[model samples]
Structures are given as structure tokens and as C-alpha cells.
Target: MVEEAPYRRIAAEIRERIARGDLAPGDRIPSTREITRDWGVAMATATKVINALREAGLVETRSGAGSVVIDRSSPQVEVVIQPDVPAHAGGFHVAASPRLRRAGEPELNRDRVVSSAVAIADAEGLSMLTMRRVAADLGVATMSLYRHVPSKEELILAMIDAVFGENPLPEEPPADWRARLETAARQMWQSFAAHPWAAEPLSLTRPQLLPNVLPYSEWSLGTLRELGFGVDEMMHIHLSLFGHVRASALNLDAELRAREDTGVTNDEWADQHGDELEAVLSAAAERFSALRYVAERGFDYDIAAVFESGLRLLLDGVAVALARREVSGDEQVDLSVV
Candidate 1:
């Protein structure tokens, strides 16, 4: 017998668990990170495993929940058409048809492929995006895509650059450094909000060297440099702003996934789980009085509002630090020690 691929073996193990009732419907399966940790496999391998499960209809991608077993017991309404039968007999049943490119369709090109991939990522989370899926969306064979985009990593980079290209910075900078930074921060946040999946690959530690993303860094650093901040301070402030926006936007993918999986919003999820949450909190009330009190009072958590409020506080702190630096006239201290 031919040996199975590594990803197929991993997928088989999970599938066996689902069959044995170890993984019930609505129960989350191992995430890509979790799979990597447990199986000593690369992220790409884990992704392939999940994709296999998804194709088998055994698991589905839920925004916040990663992958979960599909509820097979749930009633499904599908149109069944008998070929060459009268439509009136089956109440206007539509025949199933293969998805294929029509005659005179627009020629497939690299730009068309990239745009289609972006549209897929925008609608579904990046986890759901694959070369096969993109090809299906574009009505082309999977291998045909390879001619345009060499690999998934390159495609993702192109997608990132495309989205960043959407929001161009103004020719004239804001009068003040703070205003310029704030504008830059908000613009970045909005871009993340628009393409929630785009935020995933961005890392503060090992940043992607994309041309479009570099301009934002240049703009922020330039703004701070004009304010007399040293190189280290400029880098820190720029990263701080980017990190805040990115961290906040990171939840967008999970939230969207969760919403799709459970058919509930963040608020709805909280409300649905409120009783269980209260019970757990009540048991620990003696040890966590503050948390218990806050839980009882009910907090209206809006991420955007919190981001706005926190941005103001962070900028205020920066302003205070800048003022002190100006007054003291001291040379920049080495913050690298921390």
C-alpha cells in the first residue's frame, strides 16, 4: 500500500476521534498552533490537516472557535432536481451544474488571481483561503494558479500589499506630531478593520519587509524625528502605535469566526454564557471581590470605543514623557536594558 502523507495521517487521527464521539459536534478541534505543539509539525502541515477535515465535511471553520465538528443532526434544506424532469413536478427545482469558465470570459492573469484571492480572504478568514479554493472561485484549474502566483506565501504577501495600497497617506502631514501619529494610528486601525485577516501575519518582533507597510513606519518615524526624538525613541513610538492597532484588530478574525460558527455576536455570546460565568464568578467571589462586583454591574465592552479611549491615554502619557524630556534637557537614556 502507498504510504499516506503526514497531513493525511494527522487528519485521520482527528477523524477517528470524531467518529468515536471524542470530538462531539460544536466541539473545537486542535488549532494550527495547538497541532504544531502537539504533533511537532509545521504550521503548513497543520493547516493542511484542518483543510482536509473541512473538505470532508467533518469540521468547519468558525471565526472565533477555529475548527469545530459540524452538527450533522441539524436539518438541511437542499434543492433536489431530477434531470430531464418537468420543473412544475418538482416545484421549480434547479439542476446542479458544474462551475466552469464560460466562453469569452476574461483572460486569467496574475492581477485577476491576486484580486480573487483577496476577495476570498476578505469574505472568509485567511484560514479558509487556499490555492484550490481560489481557483474554484476564479473558475480555473488549481495548477493554472501556479502559473500566476508561485506559492501561498507570495500570494499572501501580494494580498497584504494590495490591502495596504488601499489607504494612502496624505501628501501634507498634520501640523503637530501627535496629530500626525494619531491620524496614522487611526488609519491603520481602519485598514485592519476592513481586512481583518490581514492583521494575522503582521508581527512586531520579526516584521514583514513589504514596501507599502514600510511607508507607515517611515511616516511615523519622520513625524517623531521632527519632534527631536532620538532613533530608539522614534522606533519605540512607531512600533507602540502599530502594535496597539494590530493587537486590537487581531480579535476581528476570531470574532468574525465565532460569529459564523455560533451565529452569535460578542455581546450575544456573553449573554448566552452569562449564567455559567456568574456561577463560576460567584464561587470565587470571596477571593475576587472586584471582579465579582464588576461582573454584577455589567460592563458594556465596545472594542472600538475602548481603542479610542486607550489611544488618548497612551498619547497623553507619551506627551507627558516628551514634555519631561524637553524640560530636563537630558540625553536619551538606554531603554534596551529592560
Candidate 2:
């Protein structure tokens, strides 16, 4: 119908203008007066067309630019589709998938929102976790998510908790402290491998005290205590070891992704760039006059290799610590840097 064709055909024209570079981001689309004149449409029809573009998030008005093209180069955001009601999904039954919150509908609860967010981050990566993207996934206005989460930081923390909670730790205790620590460490590593996004939210020195994480620490300290160590020594060993494990494994997923993105084998990069690296060092020595005095470590480690080596070294240090502490007259056992 000509009456409704303005809304239908106009969007296609706008999209074409964008593709052909006749319009670009920050360039204004035709005003209602221009649309009426050019399209030979009624005033109300032009208004409807413009409103449709706004709702589609294709254009926005700026003070100087008027109703300009939206930046398509900007990252895409999406809301999740709600799970359909099953024949037997009762009110009391737990929903297996996330439920999207639509505007003017009952606001979705926090867990559903967080669950949906975590699923997206898991499938993609941490950088994909944006307010606009999550809202689109939920089929709601971007601002609507703010009512559920005060900020994106809070949303990230919630996502970490949800994903971590999925793989619960084994209930039983191990025969020795070493065995227990090994089990816990392996579990944590595997859990991180499951969701590569988990690494970004965690901190080494200032970790958020998720109760789930605390249990592992408590178990670590308790094991030390059982080995006849005092609370002070226990804290030192446990915290230090935890820090080592985190440093070694936290960024494993990120490093792999980076390697894939660069699309150059680590060895090949080194081979081609080795001369460039030397040239840069020589230039720095000539230019700065301070670099020639210090000894260079002369080492470039493959990140994948470092990950495994660091893990082994940390466990070895822990082994040495346990041995020295158990010595009869070791004179306080200087185990630092072991």
C-alpha cells in the first residue's frame, strides 16, 4: 500500500545511501520537509519513516547534525531471545535457559540477566560483554539493564560467580595437603579453560572474595596448619602460592587468542623480527647512551612454554617449603624465592 510504503521502502533507501557512501556517520538524513518534498509523501508519513529509523537504531539527532546516520562501525549489540514456555515448565520449575526482559513486560530477575550475559561472554570473549550487547540479548532497552545491575562492573562480577558456580568442587578431602592443593589447582585451571572470560575479572593481589574461592584458600591454610605451621606462616605460603598459580594460568586463554589473532607462528615471528629487535637495541644504545651499561637478559619466552614451566616451578617451590618447615633445627627455614 502507498500509505505504508514510505516506512517500508525508505529504510532500504537509507541503507543504500549508507552503502554507497552518499551518507555516512554524523551526516544528516533528509529532514521531514525534504522527505515530504522528495518522496512526495504526507507530513505524517515522513514522521513515521523517521520514527521507524530511530526505533531501528539507524539514526539519531545531534544538535548540529540533525537526524544523522548511526555509526555502523560501532560494535554490534544484541539482546537475548527469551526461552519459550514448554508444555511442562511450571512456575516452580527452574528454567534451563535465560529469560529475556522486554520493555513494558515484567522486569526480568537478576539471575536470568546474569546467566544470559555469562553465556554470551563464554561463547565470544570478554570484550564482547557490553551493556548494549547484553541488553540486545535480553530484547530490552540498553538502559533497562541498569535497573538490574547498577553498573557493568557489577554485571561482570555476577557473570564470574554464575559461571564459577556451575562446576562445583568435590566434597571429600584428600590424604595430604599437597594432594588437596593439587586437586584444587587442577579444578581451578579446568574451570578457567571452560570460560576464557573468567581471567579478566580476577585480580592477583586484590581478588574479590567470592565465597566459592575462599573455601579453596581456607583448605590451603588448613592443610598448612595440619602440617604444624603457625597461622602467620600458613598465610604467607598459601597467599604466595595462590598468587603464583594465578600469574601462571590466569592469562593462558588470552595469550592463545592473541596468537590466533596475529596469525603468525611464534617461532616465525622471532625468526623474521630477530634482526629488527637487535637493530632497535643498537639504536637505543646509540641514541639514549644509558642502555649499553646494563646487561640484557637475552631471553624471549614463548608464552605457552612459560605457562607450563611456571606451574611446575610453583609446585616445586611449595614442595621445598613443606620439607624445610618440617626440618627439626632449620633455624626458621628461609624459604623465600624457593
Scored by TM-score, the top model is 1
- How many clashes does each candidate structure show, in the order listed? 5, 7
In model 1, the runs with Cα more than 4 Å from the true position are 1-105, 331-338
The sequence of per-residue lDDT tens digits that candidate 2 reaches over residues 190-270 is: 667677677767876687888567677777787777666777777787777666556555566566445444546665666
lDDT of each: 0.73, 0.62
Per-residue lDDT tens digits for candidate 1, residues 1-338, read 98767787888889889989999998988876567767888868877776556545566544445567777555541222224432221111123212323235568898888887787677557886889767645545689999989999989988888888889778798777778889888888888888889998887999888888888888899877766678898888888888888888887678876666556899988899999989988888888888889888998878788778878887887787677676687545232211
Lowest summed-lDDT stretch of 10 residues in model 1?
88-97
Q: TM per model?
A: 0.69, 0.56
